[model samples]
Target: MGALDYVLAGVAAVFLGPEMFSLFGLPVSLALAMVVLGFLTGILVGATPGLGGPMAMAISLPILISLFGYSADALLPVMGFLIGVMKGATVGGAVPAILFNTPGTADAFMTTLDGYPMTQRGQARKALKVAHVSSAAGDTFSDIVLIVCAPFLAIMIERFLDLPEKTALLLLSLSFIATVVGGSAGKGLIATGLGLLAAFVGTGEDFYPRLSFGTEALSQGFGPAAVFLGVLIVGELFRGIEDLWREKARSGQVTQYDLSGDQSLGWADLRRLAPHIGRSALIGTAIGALPGIGSSLAATLGYTVAKARHKPGAGDPKMGEGAPEGVAATEAANSAVSGANLIPVLSLGIPGNVAAVFLILAAESIGGFTPGPSVFRFTETAVNPELVIAFGLFTMMMLANLMNWTVGGVFMRSLGFLVRVPRQLLLPVVLLLTLTSIYVETPRFEVILFTLGFGVLGYLMRRVGMSPLPFVIAYILGGRLEETARQAFAATGADPFFLFNRPVALALMVLALLVIVWSVRPKGEAS
Candidate 1:
């Protein structure tokens, strides 16, 4: 098929595929319906304290899989829902931060800096509008980059990279991720090692499970649902519960702000904010294209740069002191990361953030799709279903963006009351819901225990300032790394020094070493 044909096929797949039901003589594709549903759900969760996209994704994945089964047909709807959640959550997370100074995630904390001050000044609605506009604009820009760049990058990698080179590339990715993710390179490496260890427990070409210790449950290893939800969701729940217990005596009431004044985001306002949004969008997109560096850093950098550039005239508010540009800069940069983060996942099969990780998990679980260079292959003789799916996914993202531009602001503004929901009351309910969902899927009591164990471990790791991101990424990619290394070794006829024999592979490995060295160096000593 031709390129145009492939594009058309993908568009058709999303708009004309399986129907949830007819909507007034028009067919509403299940994927489209799921996107809408997930978008709304995402906003709800993101507006609430102590919940965000990853948490929502983790809780919903098992249920979606159970409902859809493991078929190629399930891919679009399941992934579409996830994509919606990602976009909606990006927009929705600013609500509480702007209204009540409570950030649902680390990135949103940057939004809260200026956003809450706007609330104090009775311009809360104006701040929300700024956030919504900047976020949607940044996201739209990032998606455009993803659509244009991922295929070309994948094609280049496919054409140029051999197995040993691929193996080295994976090593470089891991090294970079380990170095950049957490507080210290050493701790990140430790987290990565633990992840690799956990991933290899029951996996390999061995006759018996490698680390099973003769237990049947161990032989099967850990389920993805258990490990992912445990570390990402349940672990956070543990932390929240502990916080709630410690702060139980504190007042639960939130200061309510009246929506008043010039809250409209007009054309002149858009033009004024466009420069900040554009700069942050570029910054965020660049950061997102790399594996493992997440949106929080992007938000921080965006806010810092905007603050530096912002010059307040007499009688005007300074940046971070109720300036709308602060909310715009932070929101745009962080939201932009969501779309561009998919670049690594689509092109290299490497997830860049937690949301991308779940998307990878969904594709892996469904069995028909595998994300990587080959997925973008173009052939005249046969249709590339993966390419079609890629375009379909892109369509869903654009659809979500459309929703964001049209109605997301209204939805987000309405969620101001969510700030009043006490964390003490909310955390346990979320905990119960997460545990129940996991149990329903696994149907084994032991998996729950294992999940709680991992959750405890996650909580401990967080307390020590060790990020769980490296661990999760390492766990997902470990098997693939081993498989690629094995392939490289065999292809080189058992050559022990095969990597060194290939200049590209050798260079990549050296680069990986340098990255670790650079990362481990003292901040004062480094350039």
Candidate 2:
């Protein structure tokens, strides 16, 4: 096909979508339906404290593959649902943080600092509105950038970056992630190393599996779906249940509340928050482009910047005490990350955060698409199906943003009744669902045990103040990194110092070294 033909085809793929059904005499694609479902599900998940975007994605991944089939044609609809969940979850997370004193997701922790205080002062509705607007606007901005940048960056990487450079870039990404993903670089490095070790088991081209230790299941390798669900979702679920027990023991019943807050937000309110939202969106977009760094940092940095620069308006609540701008600032930054997190995933096959890790899993499980520069290649001889899926996923995110604008307020308000649901009741249901989802993916009981082992490891890691993110991301990238490094070595004739053969590779390694040093540097030394 010609360029125009491809463009038209891509546009059609995006709008028409796959998995169609009739809706009142109109044919509606499941991709479109998923946008709505995913957004509503996001609200449900994000309004509840134990769930997050990754957990939603994890639970849906195997089920989506089963429904859509492991064909290239299934890519669009599955990806569409995933992208929708991502956008919706980011927006919905602020709801609980505003309505109750609890944050629904890790990234929403900052929102609670200002949001719950607003609730205490009878501005709960206003806080929710600010959060909703900022989240939608910021998400839209980031999605636009993803639309423009993902393709361009993919093309650039394809054209100029050879295997050596790619390998080095991957290394740099890992180095940066290990250093900067969370506090205590030593712990981060340890977690990442453990991930790499775990991922290597039963996975390789060699006749003898790298780390399987002679077990049949280990030799076969654990699927990403199993590992991530174990580490991210199940692990968090375990912790959440423990937390619920503690909460139940501490306070059997919680205080009830009436919605007495001023729910109205005027145009003046929008004007007031416009600057903070804009600044944080841009900041979040930039951060999202980098590999491994996550929305929590984006939210924190945005809140920090807003606090430093903001001057309280006369008779207006201060930013920290209960300011609506504080909600906007926090939400916008975290929401902006929803799109930007895809940049590396779409362009270089590097997942930027936990959510992006599931996106990779979805793409892999559904088949027909691989997330990398190759996926973006324009082949005139044949149709590039992955590109079409990419466009379709992009469309799904926009639809989600539109949903956030239209029905999000009603949904958040509706969930006000659920803000105080007993966690003791809630967590058991989540655990059962998680177990069922995993069983659906693999009928084997041992797989469940293996996953539980990882979950226990994850829980202990968190209990000891270590971040699980680095471990998850590192595990996902480890085998790929090894494969690329081997390719580069083979290309350079098996030299031990093969990376030194390319100046670009050498420079990238140096950069990685510098970033590791900077990330691990002591706070006292810096001061």
Candidate 3:
């Protein structure tokens, strides 16, 4: 595996060799360019009210695939870009949430609770700056966790786990995700079950395709990218456009803000937030490590915990009034989760969220890399002294953050001007970009059709009380769960009790059952 890792790295370097050169006595390596691009992309995606990191990645993947070709060298920049989007979007959500009382993403909803109030009081600059700094701090801290814990966790799994245990571990991971995410125990279980079912929609082993609906495309494995784009990106775009139209019909003017004030924070303000940063970072990292939990939940949880932990008469001026600490806590927690989410994906090959699942898919499509313990082995071989690759990844993320903070800040501050552009002009530009990007990836009209179809489904789901998170999560984990179950069954000659024979598997099954029961029990009865 180590040798294979080196070979892959070598191949990546070779493919990217032409792009590497010296400029101003600094190594302008291909990796460096990718990192910068990742950062820029993040800023662009984050600053937009409706756009998000995942959507940005979806749009970029196709373009990158066509331009760079499918190789690790090509893939690394895209990964860097995703990292940038993650960091940028974490903070960027605050913009619309604070100014217009519209959350760009669910995670930023908490921010708007107080943030918009501050804006109404003409403290928009202060709120924006606090949100930005706090987000950066949280994201940086989470990256530190990734740097420290990923290798250790990977080694533990690689050294100790057998197939049964690994399978059990993945099941346990899924259980934890469902428990933490769905809020109620029953809903989580139901959601997980639903996710598993969704994952089974395409072809499986045994030369049987389970739920293809007699379509030829169904006989082949479905494209994960297509599904993600359709359900998440396209759906959101349509919804955004519809909302824009509604806003137009109701009010002749789109929301606008004033950011001319000097709202920069001093060292004293930062010092006040230092304590909360530490706590929020921990919360975020822990939540991120768990499967199914997303950054938005982490942000809300961080805010709640921060409020709870406030000292009597600490008189945090920002509490409920959009205090800087509120921004810091939520931002840190949400941003930290980004790095933490990657831990499970890189170390154990289990995706913690929809973005991570897409990352795994992209890695497979471009680099032929299967994420898990084996990734470490192969990376060690391909890049040698695996630390270099790790360091490279870390460097890329750091660079992305730096770029995001500096460039993104300016862009956000200037957003008041950009939003001034007529909706008539802006909407068309956005639509064109979306259509062009979609076409570049699939080049099939059917892909666009599916995208629109899923977009409507997404809109409808939102209209109902259902969250799209569970559906997306289910879609991602579906295939893996089935494969593991099948493998377990085959190893035991299809014996129903075989899964129970193994202690680890038995334990997981018991725990999952207990969770299901506990989740369904009357709320007050158990708690």
Candidate 4:
């Protein structure tokens, strides 16, 4: 099949797939229905203070797998839902930040600076409109880039890289992620090492398990669903519960707002905000294309740049003082990050952020869809199913963007009540839901125990200022890394220093070392 033929086949697979039910006498594809459902659910979770996109994705993944089962036919519907959650949550996060000065995640913090101020000035609706429009536009721009660039990048990777080179490239990616993801390079490395250690505990080439210690349970290692939910969702819930306990009185208080005046976003308003949106969209896409940088940094950079360039006139607000442009800049940048983060995932099989992690996890669990250069291969005689699935994913994202542009604003603006739901009540419910869902999937008590154990580890990591992102990514890639290294060694006729023999591989390893050394350098010397 040619590239164009693969693209069309993918579109047909999504639109003409198995029917979930009939809507208005027309058959509704299961993937299409799940996308819409996930989008709406994403908005609800994103608006809540203690819940965000990653947590929702982690909690829902187990349930999704249980319901759909492990079949090739289940991949599209499962992936479509996850993609919807990712896109919807990016836009929904701005709602609570604008109306209630509550940010569900780090990326939404910048939105609160100007968003809450706008609410105080009775421009809450206007701020939300600006956020929604800017978010939709930025996301659209990033998706187009991903659609155009992923296949080209993947093809280039397939053409230029051999096994040894690929192994070295993976090392470079891991090292770069470890150094850049957290406050201290040392702590990040520690987290990465621990993740790799945990991943190595189960099976290997030997007849016996590598690190099982003669325990029957450890022989199988940890389940991916349990590990992800424990570290990402359960761990956060534990921390939130503790924080809320300390500030019970303050957390319980609810403030009422009189939202009135200039609620409409007119053509003139969009014209004024266009420059900020465009600049931040570019900034965010560039940053998000790199592994481990994340949307929080993009939001911060976007807000800082827009603030520096902002010139307030008479009867106008300053950048952080109820300016609609402030909301637009932050929201646009963070939203843009969500789509561009998928570029590395599709091209190199490397996840760049928490949301991308789940997408990779879904593909791994579902099987029949390996996310790498091979996924984009076009063969003349045989049909490439992964290529069709890739196109199907792009179509799902476009569907999500369409929903965002049409009815998303109306739905987002009506979510002010979510801010009033205290974490004290919400955290326990989420914890219970997560545990119950995990039990339903595996129906084993030991799996729950493993999840709790990992949850404690995750909580401690958070308390010590270490980010879990590096750990999670390392865990996901550890087995693949080992397999590639083994292949590279065999391919080079059992050469001990095979990496140093190839110029590209040697250069990548040297670059990886330099990245770590540079990250640990003194601020004055580095500058």
C-alpha TM-scores of all predictions: 0.98, 0.95, 0.85, 0.98
Task: For residues 1-527, write the lDDT of model 4, one tens digit per residue.
Answer: 88889988888878889999998899999999899988988888888888998888877887899889999889999998998898888889999899888898899999999999999998888999999999999899899889999999999989998889899998998899999997789998998898888778886899899899989889988887678778877888888998888887773566767978879999999999999999999989989899898998899999999999988789999988999989999999999888899999999998899898888888888799988888988877999899999999999999999999998889888888988886789899999888987888778889899888888988999999999888888888888899999998999999989889889999999999999999998876421
How many steric overlaps are in each model, in order?
A: 0, 0, 15, 0
lDDT of each: 0.90, 0.82, 0.68, 0.89
TM-score of 4: 0.98
Name the 10 consecutive residues with the lowest summed lDDT in model 3: 379-388
Best-to-worst TM-score order = 1, 4, 2, 3
* Clash count, predicted structure 4: 0
Ranked by lDDT from best down, the candidates are: 1, 4, 2, 3
- Candidate 3 Cα misplacement greater than 4 A, ranges: 1-22, 182-198, 206-210, 241-248, 252-262, 311-318, 378-391, 404-411, 418-436, 492-495, 524-527
- Stronger candidate by TM-score (2 vs 3): 2
Which stretches of candidate 2 lie above 4 Å from their native place?
1-7, 256-262, 525-527
lDDT of 3 by residue, 171-236 (tens): 776666666564565455565665566567666765668787777666654456656666666667
Error of 3 at 252 (Å): 5.5
Report lDDT (Cα) of residue 144, candidate 1: 96
lDDT of 4 at 506: 95
